[model samples]
Target: MKQFGAKIQSFFNSRLGFFVLAIALFWGKTYWAYQTKFNLGVAGSMQDFLLALNPIPTTLLLFGIALYMNGRKSYITMLIIDAITTTWLFANILYYREFSDFLTFTLIKGSGAVSNNLSKGILGILNPTDFLVFADVILLILLLSFKVIRMDIRPIKKRFAIGVSLLAALLFGANLSMAYSDRSGLLTRTFDNNYIVKYLGLNAYTVVDGVKTAKNSAVKANAKASDINSVLSYLNKNRTTPSVTYSGVAKGKNVFVIHLESLQQFIIDFKWDGQEVTPNLNKLYHDQNTLSFDNFYNQVGQGKTADAEMMLENSLFGLPEGSAMVTDGTSNTFQAVPAILDEQGYTTAAFHGDVPSFWNRDNTYKSWGYDYYFSKEYFSSGKNYDVGYGLKDKIFLKDSAKYIEQLPQPFYAKLITVTNHYPYTLDKANTSIKQTDTGDDTVDGYVQTAKYLDQAIGELMTWLKTSGLDKNSMLVLYGDHYGISGNHKKAVAKLLGEKTFNDFDNAQFQKVPFMIHMPGLKGGINHTYGGEIDVMPTLLNLLGVKNTGTVQFGSDLLAPNRNQTVAFRNGDFVTPTYTKVGSRYYMTQTGKEIEKLTAAQKEAVNQATNRVTTELSLSDKVITGDLLRFYKPSWFKPVDKKDYSYKLSNGLKQLKEAQEKKKTSVLMKNDGKSLADEYKTDAPELKTSEAESASSSESAAADESSSSSSRSSSSSAAK
Candidate 1:
């Protein structure tokens, strides 16, 4: 016993022990992302404990580099410098995820939802102290493990300290070169101020400014007249609060929101086995009021899908303009859609197939005015996971509907589906898995998920009818974004059965799927080039609910005079507008009034870009666990809570109300409000989600090859 104690003490005294401990501490964080197929509730288990026993492989892989370091005359000093730098990076991302700190003052100018807004939000909230503590723990453990010890550095000469500083500077420059990082002009300024100018000999000022100027010039190149008109009009209309509000007759009607993962329109265009991948969707194209918009696009620049949905639902845009879901922690969303419903005495709830906090969604949903959040944990299912992370969509839908249908008189629900989540492969032979993927079973899993989605819809509809609420539901479904970025070119070619080729990913990247299922309403089709942001305004317009949330970034799709236009940014460059006609552009920024575009285009591009960037930046804040104050006073729907502070004094009103309410509804005739003769006086025939009235889906027998034939048949049958 005495010998063991001595051994342990000796280990702690050795320098080698502390090095191992530090490495282990940093690596421990890998377990936070506990997702793997065929595993249930086994997070941070064997892997966390066992990884250290077999560090041989990692050590061998880096042995060459370490050996090279040994050849240097200043190997010990260089090692210390490199170690500290690595530790810094680890602490920045792992401990804080940069949730509270903004990087550059200049880049913060734009109110965009993308291009750079999200990136800024991400870098802002980092906690250096947490990581440093973790580092300290590591050092403490290393000190206990007596391996080959290098000791006594504080007593070294002053010249040695300077040499170490120079080495650190060299390593930092190398890191900058190898990191492949990009920054916005404003953020770049901050980076220069903090790291580049002080540490690197280069004038970070010139470099950052050059980047910003270059970006501005590149954007100027991607402009159009319609774009210019839209932006300038927005600016003219007041950059602050909106002057106009929408009102309609959607009272007493049940609202249903379904979020389809990775849904896109290009599914209808992309060929699959010699035909369209989404033949059913395409065939339904002309069945409704198709707008065939000349221009409409998604403004989210990065973190694509999350950015897409956050901006749409919150009436906010994405980063560069603001922050992203995981980076920004200062978003203001409590004044969005749910708040509108809450004013009308409607019950509000949100659902997701994954952990509620994965993207900081748990906190953000409340700001949108939801009364309850249903994440995987709350669902509390006993079924085993065939694939990791959450329940299958079919099950979630069937189950969630049961819970939602029981809400008070009126309700607003956000259902975010996840069966179609990425990592596209699943463990074989897992009977519990609804959307299982085997190595050779790609199509089967996806197809099964589609069928599962249909089943989920069917189940939800059944609940509505059985619950005696069939005629009072209004439903809307939209894609979060395209499925995870993969080998799109290869997938497209495979779907089309085309010859193998290099470089060609079709417009399928921009497409997914969307639908609005408004029960008790007349059935028709809508074809407007609308993004998610337009959904709320469009809904409010239909419901006779006034719009309190309008920021020149989006307009009510039903508004007749509204221009359906959108812009996208690709790697620092603004992409041309993506319209129903397809992607095309021929514009310049100098205000030249060519028949195609003019100076107005420049203004529009900047405004739109700025809006998106701001949204992105803000979204990050929500995802990182901070709530910004929302002051939109225009939200006066009947169901909304006039004061959110009832919780501070009342202690837990929202939670109590949620538990007490059985169900709720909002509608025109039900609320005794008069229906508007037209949602938009100018667009008397405007299509809306209220037109979605059916229950069961007919997606089953639909096939790509028979798309055209089916459409023609359906048309003839109807005629």
Candidate 2:
């Protein structure tokens, strides 16, 4: 036993052995980061295994050069290198917690506000076990301090050090080549950021991301205003005017936009266990006052839900990569819907049940000219109020009634729901619907949460009607993006009773719900092929608000001569006849590729492809170069962000002042009282959770007691 101990001690004391130990430490730290920080699935798959092993060659090549230095210089160099690498990994872990994405040079360049915005709670990202990453350095320091090991003065041979580095380099090259061969077009194709990190290591992903950012920056710097001529010409020639019959139908009405997160069109009337999955949405879909679209596709880019927002508000495409709101949105100029409505005597505010800074929205909303922005801080943050993403859908809608009732008349407001987000999970106490046992947990959970969202929407509509706001309000509801990705296709296939899921099925799944409910209007399902980009023009036209001088990329969907070709950020397109994904063209009706095409058919496909490519390139340049700053519309003025505040404490006072000044607020017309008193709900959370139920009971008792006191005072005065 003593002999074995001595041999282990000797191995640790040796210079070559310590070098090997350092390599292991570096590699181990990287693997730890992969397991903890990223959500890249199992380690059993060959692709994932290769990614786990990727940190080795880079670490070896980096540390191999340190061997050329003699004695303490060599030892200190390795320690410094290890510190830098460890710091990089630690920083990425913190960033991934908020963004769920790796860092880019663009993000790093604008990281000035990151530190100040970071709350101490972000440190929760670090686990106690993470400290083991520094164990090697601590162990080395202790042994050297006790004089248990002495440094070797001899230098490693230069030829040996160089040879080690060269071998490592060759291995890294082969690793990259194998990754590319395994995932076809791995380095070039438009894919999810997660795929890049899963196929290649985070280090390699960062390097690739850096290269792409640089390339985009270079393209923007070299672009000119004249490059927009073709884009402007195309838009002007194809511009769609509002239909004479529908124009001014909902003029001067308050607008309420309900953003349904991750909802798809299929859920509109989908049945589960012989019951309607979304009964509330089913009623609205069939209602005579609602104009719903069955063929509305979500043309979002990498920003997903935020991309949908960008298109709906500004008729602008999101960036080809990261969210425009996070990347270039803060600095770019936009002729957004809120600002346009502001010119027409409308008060605009946005409500979200999450922190303002999560997606850099606190900064971007100001640029969009919102008069007030209410985030999660304004809502109830008490027990049982929040779910995974933010506030529970029921609690969020209930709490928002307080502020929504106070907004000045003719307000343009938006409510963003989050309970139906990805990896959907609902507390049993909150959920009343029966869950499916579909083997796939996500798809099963998706149905329950989606049903919950429908219930919340029903409660909101009831509030609107009882509060008397429904008579003069236009309600717009839209699904932000797809709920399930291709990863869950098999489960979705079983749910839909399909034989097999294919690319066509995936493409069809991209359809998102878009509905507009206007009181006393002729409404029915419209089968036009439109997207989120067309929303702005359609709403503005219906409200009798003209955006005559704006540079919008989409035509009004309600127009008599609307353009129906929808272009995706990836250069794919969908028209009434054909769907183009990459180089292949398929019939939209049949989803089959055409082996042969007539001359007219080929010409039509070529024209659509050219239009899509040109539009995407122009949009990219507009965002990256901040070119909109140069194009000032004659009727538009740049928003002064300094005028708005998101602070919740002063909310009541702000609402009162606006009402007193205008004398046009609906709350004032209803005798200086809030409309939330009329809101009725039987949500399970409100009934089952003690905290929520107590709060609701207390509010009701207070209102009743106040009414009783008022009657007694009036009777005594009469006597």
Candidate 3:
């Protein structure tokens, strides 16, 4: 036993042995993360084998670089390489825990905005097993420091080191060949990030992402004004006219968009434990003044919430690989909803409980021509008030009422909620619903957060009505994306009482609630098949805003003869007759896979597939090329991003100035009085003292109303 131990130690002390050890450690950590930490959906033995084998080439290539050096430097380089890769792996683990997706180059580049208030969340996401990601690094450092693995100072021929790198390249080629055989169009058609990581490992996935990002940047730089011509032609051909019945229905009305984070449509009236999960949303969805769509889907890519927002604002699809908001938002010109409304004499503002940099909204909102932005810096915060991604939904809505009241009348306001985001966690005091018995913490906690969001929405509705804002406002509430990912299929199946779940079910699970509520407006459930891309057009049509000559990819959903094909960010699409999940086709009504397609079904699928491909390609061209910079609409003026400032003091000053000028605002219309006291919430974190203070302030304002009016009159006269 002693002789064998000595032999092992001697081999590890050799140069080649050290290189092999580094590869093995990196390979082991990556596979471990794949199996346990990430939900890559490794199904068959082929995928399992690929997952194990995929790491070898990348590991060899990385550690092989160290072989070029001689002596202790080689050993140190190998260790440093190992440490860096391990750090990246650990970072992805933390990111995947929240986003249910892998990190992209775009996300990393934009990390500065998201890093604020991230430490507390990171601590919560950490698992004891996560330490294993760095276990090999620590072990290796200790071994080298203790001289257990002595460095070999032998000089190797330069040819030998070059051969090692060449061999790595050859192995990577073979790996790619095998991956293509298993999953056709793996690189060309990257429908999901998990596919890349699953087949080529994390290192290769990063390479692919980096290459794609570079190509996109190059494409944007070399793009021409004529590049928008093809896109304009496509839009002109596919554009649908607005419905005469619904057009001008909400003209000149204030627009209030409520972004419901991670709230899926399945929970609209879903009963769990014999209780309604979203009672308030269900009621509002069924209200006579609400136009709700049951067939609405979210077409987000890696960008998720930001993608949905992009679609809602510009009627465009997000990039296939990363968030356009993060990558192109600052530089790209957009004919967004805010700017479109701003041209029509409407004040545009966005209220988010998160930091301005999150999703790059700080720069993106300015690019979109928002006159005011109320971010986390503008909101009051405490331990109880903040949770998950940002401020609690109830607290966010409750605090936003003050700003909402100060916004000019007929304003375009967007309030983005963040409590129901992924890794949905809520304090027991805030939860009013029972958790599900699915045994998946993520799925179980989803209902509680969703319920809390519903309560917040209910409170906002009550306050809007009490302040008479509801009388002249169009309230649009929409779920941003899916709460539970396809990874939790079994838990979702159990929750839905389904006997079995498959790809068809997973595709169907993408549905999210979209409702537009306006008092005395003709409203009912519209079964038009559409996605987030259609939101801007639909709303603009209803508001009597003409989108003629605009470069929008989506048609008005209320149009009588509008095509009802909904294209996902991925190449997959859903139509009224057919649903495509990957290469397979399924009947939309029956959810049965078509083993042998009929002649009619084949044609339908082919046409829909072609359209989806063409639309996605054109949209990608528009974004990656920043084509909007050239295609200036006659009715629109491009936003000068420098004109906007989201600072709290600046926004407050603007509001104050507007009030002094007697510009119409909710508060100004109410005789220079705030309606903050009208807002009511059952959130446990809201202290009674706070409520009393608000009431006291309202009372004091009432007492000084005459003097305040005189002072306002004097100020207006002076101005």
Candidate 4:
């Protein structure tokens, strides 16, 4: 036993042994992360074997560089490399916990905008097991410090070190070849980041993403005005004329886009333990005055909510790699909804209870031509009022009424809620509904937060009615993205009462709630298959705006001949008749896999597949090449980002000045009285001094209302 122990120590003290140890530790840690942290969907023995073996080539390639150095330096260099790589792994782990996707260079470059908002979220999603990623680094450092693994100062031969690196290269080549064999067009036709990481390892995946990003940048640099011709031709060919019945139905009305954070379609009418998960939303969805879509999926990429926003506003798909809003938002030209509405003599503003920099909205909203932005600084925020992503939903919606009322009439406003975001955590006092017993905290708490959001929405709706804004405004409410990701399939399966969950189920799970509500409008649940990309065109049609000759990928949903194919970001697509997930096709009606497709089915799938590919590719080209810079429509005016400023004082002053001079605001029209008093909530956080202050403010406003009315009457008489 003594002799064996001495031999083991001696071997570890050698240069060769140390290199091998580092490779083994890195490979093991990466494999563990793959199996535990990521939902790579590794099925079959071949995939399992490839996933385990894929880490080796990259590990060898990275650690092999240390072989060229002399003993102690080589050991230190290998440890440093290990620490860096482990940190990268740890970052992805944290990112994947929320996004369910890998990191890209674009996201890294744009991190500065969102980093401040992520601190609390990062701490919330962290697991004790995540620390194990650094276990190898800690072990190596401790061993070196204790002198348990003595350093050999001998220099390795140059030829031998070169040979080691060459061996790593050869192994990587083999790995790539095998990966290609298993999955054809693995790199060129890459669909999901998961496939890249699953087949080529995370390190290799990062390299691929970096390469693609660089390629995209190069493409943009070389792009010309004529490059938009093809995109224009495609859109024109597929453009669907707006329905006469629905077009101009809500024209000249105020537009209020309510962005529901992380609310999925399943929760719309979902019942848990005899309790409706979203009773308020369900009521609105089924209301005769609301047009709801039952088959609206959120097609977001790694950018998630930001991606959804990009699609919703621009009628453009997000980049397949990262969030275009973060990566290209500052520089890219957009004919976004806000800009369009602004051109139509409407004041455009956005309200959010989070930091201006979160999702890079502060910069992106400007590019979108929003005249004013009311962000976290505009709201009352503190520990009690703020939760996961920003201010509690109830508080955010209640406070937003002040600003919403201040906006000029016939305005376009987007209110982004944040309390129902991921890591769905709500204090016990705020949680009025029962949570699901899914044995997963994320899944269980998701219900609670979603219910809270619904309640908040209900309060906001009531305020809108009492304030009389509902009569003139058209409300567009949509779930931003999926709240419970596929990572919690077990809990989801339990909650859904499914014996088993499959990829088809996951594809179907991406459906989100989309509704348009207005008074005395033709409305019902419309079974149109659409996505966020369709929002801009659909809304524009209803506003009596013609999208002809514009470069939009989506057609109006109200168009009788509108294409029903809903393309997901990852190359998968769903339609009314068929749903394709990865390499498999399933019948949309039955959710059964189609192993033996008939000739008609095959043709249908092929046509849909081509359309999906074309749309995604064209959208990518438009964004990556900034094609909008070249394609200016006669009716559309390019937005000068300089015209926008989201500073709290400046925004409030501008709104106030506009109201005083023009009396164009809803509040000004209502006799210079604020309608914030009409908003009520059962929020526990507001049940104290905050509530009292609100009451006092309401009373003060009431007491001064008669005087304000007299002043208004005198001004009107003078005019």
Candidate 5:
């Protein structure tokens, strides 16, 4: 006891002993974290963990161990290593242009997280993971004091071994916890969000989160099971409600909606040199009465590209925050555009290049009412050439053609091409853009992929014309989101054209292109901006078919009433977030908002956000495929459509804000430095073009948009 007390006393008294212990534990914990998230999907060991700790600590811990063994000379080597790690961690948080823990709002609040440690001078010895070492140093300082310090410093065989064991245990614990934490975030929040409000405290959190999760899960299952009863009951009561027949196609008229991967709209502009990149699309714009929706933006968070589909086709919003569609376990719920077409006697099908299971698109399509689906695994294996990720665009198109031949008359087909995905390499790998942009894969790959996609589109268009379907069918295409193409500016510049392709939606991402080609309605254009969510209903209205608005949360752009805002979710969240509110027919993204919006404008924003978010309540249903055979018109209700824009109230509201911002900027600039109020703007010029388009559509929807009396539709067509 006396010796143990003396050792404890010595640890508190000796800086050298305390420092060594901190170093040992720091490196140990770090190595454990690194190993946890490495490639392995499992979180059993330290190394198998996903999202492991930063690597700085491990390096420093080794240095400390060396110092303890050798002598003061260790400081020279240790300092060099420490300097590098510190700087890197500091910079990581600072720039956060790339993802870093410090940059994330979710991670910023954790205790023991490090900051302000990066330095340029320490570049030589520090490995990327070294900074984790410094964090341990700090953590030790925070947790241990005098007597406790000695507890960490003991005999080399005993104390050091114990510390190592302790580290492994803690590390394993943290890794498991981390994985659990993510699952818990989604499971717990979902439980709380779903039942906490309705069932009172019965849905309270249970032990180890298992109780609440179990009960909550059961509730969800029960709730979903109940949807059928409710829907069936509703159907019986509403059986008297007759469905309109869908024979609207005038001869060979067909519409094709193609969703591109991460193609933002801001990729074109004369100023951006985008004119050449999308020459064909641009050509279509001017030659055909093409309406380019300039302020069109996607607000999908997480599941970035898929979210575009969620919004565009199903009028569904982004997923919940922190949960991924890939990991959400529970599939999303909702009806798809195919259901309506199936009722109308059109073949409803879906096509994709990746494993249908990746995003659960396979199961999801069934729920969305797709009568047929072609996923990567089940795609015709005999088809040949450039088998990059899963299948090439050319092959995708070729495969699509095969399906088209077998498709029923007046079919509604959705083809999602995936050749544009990362690594951007093709059989004919083009590297011209790489020379100019240096380190930008976004540019290099985008140019190559965009060109490839363009060629494919041209082929598809040509085939349609040759097949004699051109005059009878409509074609629409768009991108999911902008690429994280290693080089943003150079890649965007190359693909969109340095001049015109410069801006798509806004500087946040390249604006996605939404192309609409209708049979018989050829050369007719509406420049009004919209997103994926609006596509389904808009098509129904354009085809002049009675749209079954079951679970729809978007305005029908083609209806022409043009009074409701088009809403989108940023594709970065698991839950719906980052709402984009454009005037029902407006295309302006940038302007001075000096004053706050009036209550009316606020209400509009609320309406748009809520209308989109309400879909989250049933995302699980969409993914589960239970609702494929059933849907409701009221579920997809559009906002109140009326010509309220340009009213004195809205104009005055905007005018007021502009004046306020102008005044504030002047006030702040009085000092030496200039201060300007900044807000995100896609552009202010697209509004006029949008208006021209909207005016035209206004004539089309003058009657239908207002006649919101629920008209029913069913997947089953009784012969």
Candidate 6:
């Protein structure tokens, strides 16, 4: 037994054994994180096997520095390397749990400001088993402290260490080349970070992000306002006028814009296993009070939902690659919807269940002229209440009633629902729908959650009717973007009963639901070809608002003679006749390729292509150059961010102050009560008794103070 113990100790104390041990520990933790923490998907291919082992070369190259050092210095180097790698792995695990994305240099640079706010939530993302990430390091420390392993003074030959590093570097090159071969043009194209992490590894993703960040920083720094002038001029010349009939139709009505997360147009009236996918949405669509667009497409870029937001607000395109919300949101100026509405005697508020800083929205919303921003701080903090994104759809809509009612009348409010977001996870208890098992977990999960979102929306609509908000409010509902990407189209194709998915099918998949409902209005399905950028102008026309001098790229869909060439951020376009992606133009009705086009068809395609490119470039120029700051419209007023703060209870504090000043708060209108009381739900997160208790306590305190003051005055008189 003593001999066995001595042999084990001797092996661990040796140079080669220590080196191998270090590599094993680092790789073990990284691979564990990759499997357990991240959503890297099923490892069913040779490429997947390679990706699982991708961290090895990088780890070896980094930790090999220990071999060049001697004695305690070498040991110290190993410790430092282990600590850094462990910390990096742990941080990414937490970040991935929240965002389903790897950490970029841009995100890390902005981390400090948001870290304190997100720390508690960060702790929640971790599990008791996650301690294994540090278990190896802790074991080493204990072993050294107890003399279980001894350090030798001898150093490894410098030449051998250098050779090993060179070998690792060569292996990395081979790994990268193989990955590129497997997923052709993997690094060159602009794609989601998931592809990068799935092909290479987390370490490769960080390096790629750093390079992209540096390039973007240079591009931003060198951009000039002069570069935007030509683009601006083109838009000014091409901008469409408002429809004569619809103008002023919904004037002075409250606007309730509900952002349906990851909803596609196909699911509007879709059914699965004898259940409607979105029954409430279908009802809203068929209602005489609503105007639904059958061909409305989502033209979002890399920002996805955030891109849709920027388009709806500014009538401008998102960046062609990354998120404009993060890359340019803080610095660029916007002639957004909220700011425009603010000029028309409207109060603006945005309610999102996710963290305000998720897309740098906390600061961007301030500049966008939102009067109040309710985010994660305002939602239930329980783990069960949150699914993939933030609060569950039920809790988010119900709890928002408390803050929603407080907004002044004729307000512009946006409710972003995250229940149908990617990975579409719903607690079994909250779900009444079942998956149809289409051989894709994502697809199966998608149907169930989409049904859940529909139910939640139905609940909200019921409350709106019961509370009488429906009559005076114009509800604008739109899907942010596609729920599934092109990668998963095969499974979706099966679900849709299509034999094969093609480029023409891809175009159809981009369609998202867009509807506007005003209680007394005549409504029907409009067959206008439009995109998210067109939404702002269409809504503005209905509200009797004008974007006369602003360089909006989108034309109003309501206009009888509106331009129908809806441009995507990637230079694709869809018109009434055709869908143009790159050099290929497909017939809209038949989905057939035009092998030999007529002169007019060719001319139209060329014109549409140019228009799409020009629009995207100009939008990029506006964002990258911060040009809107140079070209402020006459009616637009710069937002005063001092009026709002998202610090703990700051929104509630502002409401209280407004009520005290008799500044026409809904709470005061209701005689010092919360509208949440009207919303009758048994959500465990809602503590109505506690809220009532606090209200009762306030009245009790007021009476006690009056008695004490009277008693004190009587005593003074006696004296």
What is the TM-score of each predicted model, taking all chains together? Answer: 0.54, 0.71, 0.70, 0.69, 0.50, 0.72
Task: Name the candidate, 1 or 5, with the larger TM-score value.
Answer: 1
Error in Å for residue 567 of model 1:
2.0
lDDT of 5: 0.46
Who is ahead in lDDT, 2 or 3? 3
lDDT of 2 by residue, 523-629 (tens): 99999998888899889888987756566787788787566788888888898899887777789999888778789989998888887787777677677776766
Clashes of 6: 0
Candidate 5 local lDDT, 599-702, one digit each (tens)? 87566556655644444444434433335334445434221112111222333353345334443222222332321111111211223445767998997686
* CA lDDT, every model vs. true structure: 0.44, 0.78, 0.86, 0.86, 0.46, 0.80
The sequence of per-residue lDDT tens digits that candidate 6 reaches over residues 1-719 is 99998887788888767777878987887787777787665345866677667988888888888888878888878878888878877877776555445666654564342354347466667778777899888887787788777777787889988988998899899888888777665666534466677777877877887886777667766866576678667977887878888898999999999999999999988888888888999999999989999999999987888899999998888887767776666545677899889889887899988766666677678668887888877776654677756788888999898887777677899999998988887777767778866789888888878888888888888888777788888999999999988888788888888898887788888999999999888799999899999988889989999768777888888888787888877787788899886778899888998888899998988888888877887788887777776675678887654445665466788756655654454566777676666775545444544576789999899999999999999999999
Query: For residues 309-381, what per-residue lDDT tens digits would candidate 1 score against the true structure?
Result: 5666655555543235433321333446776677777777777766554454543454465667666554535
Q: Which ten residues in a row have the lowest lDDT in candidate 4?
A: 111-120
Model 1 lDDT, residue 10, Cα: 64
Q: How far is candidate 2 from the true structure (C-alpha RMSD, Å)?
A: 9.1
* Local lDDT at 621 for model 1: 35
**Who is ahead in TM-score, 3 or 4?**
3
Clashes of each: 112, 0, 0, 0, 112, 0
Higher-ranked by TM-score: 3 or 5: 3
Q: Which window of ten consecutive residues has the lowest lDDT sum in model 1? A: 677-686
Candidate order by decreasing TM-score: 6, 2, 3, 4, 1, 5
The collision pairs in model 4 are none
Largest TM-score belongs to which candidate? 6
Backbone clashes in model 5:
112
